[model samples]
Target: MTNSPAGHTPNVVLITGTSSGIGLHAAIAAAQAGHTVVATMRNLEGTRALLDAADAAGVTLDIRRLDVTEAQSVTEVVAGIVGRYGRLDAVVNNAGSGHLGTIENETIDQVRAVMEVNFFGVVGVTRAALPHLRTSHGRLITVTSVGGVIGQPFNEAYCAAKFAVEGFMESLAPVVRSAGVSVTVVEPGAVATSFVANVGFDPTAPAAVGDPYAAGLAAYLARAGSSFASAQTAESAGSVVAALLDGDVPPFRVQTSDAARQFVGVKLADLDGSAVQRLTSGWIA
Candidate 1:
């Protein structure tokens, strides 16, 4: 997809992890909306289905290779896009994975792996894309989970990574605002995708799982899987983020799903003045 011929077409958007789920849907939606879409994955071979969707929609798309973890991959992908397209108008950082286990039992390597993909990978992609984004005065949209804001029993590693991303994006937004780039974090609730199927869990490696906590974690996973089975589809989340990509003065954070709204609202609101005052009374007083 080349830059808008007249610099006044819809816009150009780049989305990550388009092999399946929300990323796949968002790429198709953005293309359908008339944007020049560059969709990337670890390998484009898995995205033939996405290509078919684009074909049916009559939207031209460019799907490419991008491994978010490799600094060279990130740099090369961004450089290739800018060289071919001239500018990048928006980016959706949707590539991520899940880790399930108690923090204590998880190996340091396991924790680092989760953080690499979820947090630092995001940082790498954003850093590589920022120059082009600045050229287009574009927006950066990140997809995070409700786990980022609230604690989920078995997903301590996943939650920690997302929480760190939340803090990172929040802090980076102000620094980039004046450079004509904006940042938004998207919090999605459970959705029925292949996410659970690919979740990383090491059964043999052992730290701490007490019986009660183990029971709760088991129940939570079951409930979550069932809820995902019954919840909205990935397409719903894709549409929301795609729409935000073109909307005016988009919010710094936009949350999707009733479940996400409920969790984020309660958790963030729970950190209000009264609570803070009481908790920090020793220092304040």
Candidate 2:
């Protein structure tokens, strides 16, 4: 097990998707806070960016290759961490892909693809690490989105997957609490990142010829552009995950920014689903 300068045992944090964005930032933040971080991504070649950032910040991470979509990869990485550290204290499920476009525009394959990464990917990782987590009485932090709480227009598939994640974690939280494991879902609103681009959506592109949903899509794009223009930084979002990992008792649900809180608050405050429908309808209208 790793030890801090003061000789206290340090937490061993496993963070997925450390190639960039929130994952990379969270790995650095955790390492800087004295936790031993095993930063994993689909491709080890992508570790250069994370390594450069960690070097600049004077933090070190044990980098590994892990593809959450692959069950073998998940099992191997988790086993390796436990073998080396003797315990796994926390897991940050940040390896996710976004899907844009309406339900009509997205094919069944595309929908399944998003679910594979955003929802089932979390399941794969959590299932693999839960044994070790239960042994250590550790934490499980998954980076969901505000869309998970209130589905946004043109984000049908992505939101559906996130909603599944939220429900799954919520249901598992109590069950795992008995085993001394905590489950927390970290929700973040729009952040300045390449997420949209990585999702293969071009907000500035001209609408597809003769598409019925073109107008609504354009409107959603405009609103997303404005939201991202004033979006929070990736580092800000990562800090939320880091904080939850370091906390003795983390809340079941947390929003990274106040804007995220406000966005998700609307849904939590509404007993009926009408308020969210009305708000979402306004975007298309």
lDDT (0 to 1) per candidate: 0.81, 0.89
- lDDT per residue, candidate 1, 170-255, as tens digits? 99998888887888999998877787668865433342545445545655656666677777789998898888777475778888
CA displacement after TM-score superposition, residue 234 of candidate 2 (Å): 0.6
Kindly report which residue stretches of model 2 are placed more than 4 angstroms away from their true locations once superposed. Answer: 1-8, 204-206
Residues 1-285, candidate 2, lDDT per residue (tens digit)?
211122446888999999999998999999988899999999898888898999999988999999999999999999999999988988999999988888777699999999999999999999999998888878889999998899888889999999999999999999998988889999999988777679878777777789999888877777778889999999989887888866457789999999999989899998988999998988877
Number of the predicted model whose lDDT against the real structure is largest: 2
- Per-model TM-score, in order, reads 0.88, 0.95
Residue 96's lDDT within candidate 1 is 94
